[model samples]
Target: MLKVTAIAAALLLSGPALAQHAHGAQKGPNGGPMEDVAGVHAELVVSGQTVAVNVFDEAGKPVDTKGYTGSVMVVSGGDRKTLQLTASGNALTGQAPGPVQSGAAITVVVKTAAGKSGQAKFSAP
Candidate 1:
């Protein structure tokens, strides 16, 4: 009984350390693993006048957005516009509607085939 109690205590103490190390394997904000927006893995990228978003599954696989739909709200030129997003293959890309200067805040919401919704927030580069 004493040996079992000691083993249980040791296991409890080591559980947190193991979990912390496991979480370390996940990617950080700067384009490593997909950023978790709300409860989904989403990626945000700004290039020229377009903002590209890549949504992935829970297993870190790119999700096909053939019938998926999404929208983006970006603060550009000191104003915000709700832009419609269209999914191409595994990505959802859209124009900012108006000219977006650098360093603008953008928020995106996507609904996948499984009726699961996810959001991702980003700033223009």
Candidate 2:
């Protein structure tokens, strides 16, 4: 009984670490929420009609955007829009054709030059 209780306590204590690894509960370097997708880190930031996604390596250093491609999907108030993202400087950026609804939920999927893909989710403030 004591061994079982100990095992349960250990699992409970490790739950957050497991969850974070699976769901990326880390904050981004670009002042946005970040997620871990397949060991890469992605950050999503939304401003008005513009959406930016930044990718980082496991060590939190910004990854080169060269040859990287991605897409963004904005969801708000039951409406959804998809935008193509291009590498700009060190980040992937795109603009919505129409004004982005405030408080929209943004999801970004990025593929690196080596073909590794990662995604991040954020909500516009």
Q: Give each model's whole-structure lDDT.
A: 0.71, 0.79
Global lDDT of model 1: 0.71
Model 2 pairs in collision: none
Tell me the deviation in Å of residue 76 in model 2: 1.2
Tens digits of per-residue lDDT for model 2 on 1-125?
Answer: 99999999999999987776544445677777777754567777777678887777777898878988989888988888889999986688999988777678887788888888867677775
Query: What TM-score against the true fold does each predicted structure earn?
Result: 0.66, 0.79
- Pick the TM-score winner: 2
lDDT of 1 by residue, 1-125 (tens): 99999999999999997654232235534353345644456777666677767766667687678877888898866688888889988778898755667777777788876677767666665
| Model 1: lowest-lDDT 10 consecutive positions | 21-30
